[model samples]
Target: MIALHCDGSLTADRASYGGLIRDATGAAILAYVGKGEENSVLGMELMAILRGIMLCIQNDLRRVSIRSDSKLAVDILNGEVGCPWAMQVLKGRIISLCEQLHSKEIRHVWREMNQAADFIAAIDTGDGESIFNPSEFPLELVELIQNDADCKAYFRTSSF
Candidate 1:
C-alpha cells in the first residue's frame, strides 16, 4: 500500500510553499518540496499532490491514498464541482490526474496525518531573509524511514 500527504502556505509576498509526505508499508519513501514558481499557495499545494500521485503511479504503486490539509485541494480531488475562474484550470488538471492514476482507492487525509508536510512548508520566503535551510526538517527521522535498509528490514518481518 502507498499513501501521500501534503500542505501549502502562502505569504503576503510573491512566495508560495508546499511539501509532500509519502509512505509505503508504515514507512515513508520520500518527503520534499515544490515551490518558487509563479503559482498561488493553493496551486502549489495542489501541485504537490499531483507530483506525489504521479510518483506513485510511475512507481507502479497499488492501492494508494493521498492526504492533505487543504480542503480546497482535497475537495477538488474528490470530484467537487463549481470552481472559481482562478482555480478552474488547475481544478481540471487535478481531475485529469485523478483519472489517470486510477488506483483502487484514494483519500484526502486529515490535518494530523499531514503535519510533517505542513511543518516543512511553513518556511516564509515572503521576507527578504534567507536564513532557512530545508535539510533541517524531519532530519534523521525522515531519512531513516526513506532509507532502503529500513524498508527492507520493515517488510522482511511484516511480509506474510
Candidate 2:
C-alpha cells in the first residue's frame, strides 16, 4: 500500500500545499510542495489532496491510503459531508481520480502526526514549488523528516 500524507498552509496573501508519499514499509517515495492560487484554507487543502492523487496516478500506484490534517477535506472526499459550493469543482475532480484507482482510502489525522507535510508547506521556497525524492531532500528538512518518521511531536509558536 502507498500512504500519502498531505497538508496546506495559508497566510494573508499566500497559500501553499505539501504532501509526502510513502510505500507500505514507510519509505519515502516522493514529496512535493507547491503554492496554490486559491485564497481559502479549505481550497488549499483540497488542492493538496488533488496533487497527491495525481502523483499516485503518475507512479501507477493502485492501492493507496491518503491521510490529511484537514477533517473537512477528508469528510468531503469520503461523502460524509457536503463540500462548500466553492469547492465543488475540486471535489468532483478528486472523486474522478479516486474512481480510477484500484483501491483508495482517505482519512484525517492529528496535526502533530502530520507535521512533516505541514513543515514542507510552511517553507518559504523562493519560487514556492519543490519536489524531493528521499535522497534529494534539502539539508534543512532532513531532521524534520526524521522526526516525522520517529513520530515525534512538533510544536509551533508564533512571533508576537
Candidate 3:
C-alpha cells in the first residue's frame, strides 16, 4: 500500500498544497508542493489530494491510503458530509481518479501529526509546483519525515 499525507496552506492572497507519497514501509517515494490559484482553504486541501492522486496514477502506485488534516475534505470525499457547491468539480475529479486505483482509504489526521505536509505546503519555491525526491529533501524536511517514521510527536509553542 502507498500512504499519501497531504495538506494545504492559505493566506490573504495565496494558497498552496503539498503532500508526500510513501511506500508501505513509510519511506518517502516522492513529495510535492504546488501553488493553488484558488484562495479557499478547502479548495487548496482538495487540490492537494487531487495532486497526490495524480502522482500515484503517474507512478502506477495503487492501494492508496490518503491522510489529510482537512476533516471536511475527507468527509466530503468519503460521502459522510455534503460537499460545498464550489468544490463539486474538484471533488468529482478526485473521486473519479480514486476509482481508477485498486483500493483507497481517506482519513483525517491532526495538524501536528501532519507537520511534514504542512511545512511543504507553506513553502515558497518561486514556481508553480515542485517535486522532491528523498535525496533532494532539505534538512528540516528530512527531519520531519524521519520523526514521522519514528512516530515522534511535535508540539507548537508561541511567545506573545
Candidate 4:
C-alpha cells in the first residue's frame, strides 16, 4: 500500500509538476518536473495528476491514496462537478476509469503542501516525472528536503 500525492502549478499556459510518494512503511520520495508551453494551466495540472495515476496503474499498485492540488481536477475526478463541454466525450471514459480504479479515494492537498509536485510541472509537460519507487531516492536527498526548508522554499520562489 502507498499514499501517492502530486501537486501542480500553472501559469497562463506553462505548468509545473511535483509529487510525494510513500510506501507502506511510510518512507517517501519527492520529484519535480515541468512543461513550459502555451497551454491552459488547468489542462497541465490535470495532466500531471493523470500521469501519476497511470504510473500507479502501470505498476499494479493498489491501496493508493492519490492526491492533487487542483480543486477543479480533483472535483472532476471525484464526480463533484458536471462534465465540461470538452470533457463530454471524456466524461464517460473518465467516469468509467474512476469507477474501475475506485478514484473516489483520491484526496486534495493544499498548494503549499504540494511544493514538490508543483516543481514537477517544470520537468516534462505531458511526459511527467519518471515513475520511481519511494525507496529509490537516497537518504541524502530525503535528508536535504527534511533539513533545508529554505531549499524547499526555493522551488516556489525560483523561476521555472
Candidate 5:
C-alpha cells in the first residue's frame, strides 16, 4: 500500500496544493507542489486528492491510503456529506480513479499531523507543477519530510 499525504491553501490570488507520497514503510517516494487551476479552497483540496490518486495510478500502485487535512473533502468523498455542485465533476473523477485502485482509503488528519504537506502547498510555484525526488528537496522541506517519516510530532499554537 502507498500512503499519500496532501494539502491545499490559498495564497494571494492563487491556490497551491502539494504533498508527499510514501511507501508502506514510510519512505518518501516523491514530493509534489503545484498551483491550482481554480482559486477555490475546496477546488484546490479536491485537486490535490485527484493528483495523488493519479500519481498512484500512474505508478501502478493498487492500494492507496490518502490522508488530507481537508475534512470536508474527506467527508464528501466518503459519502458522509454531500458534494457541492461546483465539485461534483472533480469528485466524480476522483471516485473513478479510486475505483481503479484495488483498495482506497481517504481520511482526514489534523493540520499539525500534515505540516509537511501544508508547508509544500503554501510554496509559490508560479504556473506549473513541480515534482522532487527525495535527494532534490529543499533543506526545509527535507527536514519536514524527515520529521514526518520519523513520526515526530508537530505542535501548533494559536492565540485566542
Candidate 6:
C-alpha cells in the first residue's frame, strides 16, 4: 500500500500545498509542491489533497492511504461534513479523483506527524512555480524527511 501525507501553507500574499508519497516501509517515492492564489487555509488544504490524489493517479497507484493535518479538509473529503461554498469545486474534483482509484483512504493526522509535508508547503519559492518530482529533496526538508522516516515526533506552535 502507498502512504501519502499532504499539507498546505498560506500567507498574506501566497498559498502553497505539498505532499509526500511513500511506500509501505516509508521510503519516499514522490514529493510535490504547488502554488495557489491567496485563499482560505481550508482551500489550500483541499488543494494539497487534490494534488496528492493526482500524483497517485499519474503514477497508477490504486491501493493508497492519504493523511492530512487539516481535519476540516479530511472531514469534507470523507463526507463527514459539508464543504463551504468556496470549497465545493475542489471537493468535487477530489471526489472525482477518488472514483478513478481502485481504493483510497483519507484520514486526519496531527501536525507533529505531518512535519515533512508542512515543511515543503511552507517553502518560500519567491516565484509561483510548482515543483514536480525534484531530482533531490531540498536541503531544508532533509532533516524533516529523515525524522518522518524515523517516526520522530515534531513539536511546533500553530497560529491557527
Question: Which digits, one per residue and each the tens of the lDDT, describe model 1 over residues 5-31?
Answer: 656666665444444445465555555
List, residue by residue over 60-113, the lDDT tens digit for candidate 6. Answer: 987889899999999998989988888898999999989998988998999888
Question: Any idea how many clashes model 2 has?
Answer: 0
Ranking by TM-score: 3, 5, 6, 2, 1, 4
Q: Clash pairs of candidate 2?
A: none
Stretches of candidate 5 off by over 4 Å are 156-160
How accurate locally, in lDDT, is each candidate?
A: 0.58, 0.87, 0.92, 0.56, 0.87, 0.84
Best by lDDT: 3
- State the lDDT of candidate 3 residue by residue for 49-141, as single tens digits: 999999999999989999999999999999999998999999999999999999999999988888889988988886599999999988998
lDDT of 4 by residue, 41-130 (tens): 555556555555556665666457777777787787777986566645444543455544643376787776554455444454364346
C-alpha RMSD between model 3 and the true structure? 2.2
Residue 40 Cα positional deviation in candidate 6, in Å, after optimal superposition: 0.7
TM-score, candidate number 2: 0.88
Instruction: Supply the TM-score for candidate 3.
Output: 0.94
| Clash pairs, model 3 backbone | none
Sort the predicted structures by lDDT, highest score first.
3, 5, 2, 6, 1, 4
Question: Model 6 off-target regions past 4 Å?
Answer: 126-129, 132-135, 153-160
* Alpha-carbon TM-score of each model against the true structure: 0.65, 0.88, 0.94, 0.64, 0.93, 0.89
lDDT of 5 by residue, 108-128 (tens): 999877888888788886888
Q: Give residue 54's error in model 6 in angstroms.
A: 0.6
> Against the true structure, whose TM-score is highest?
3
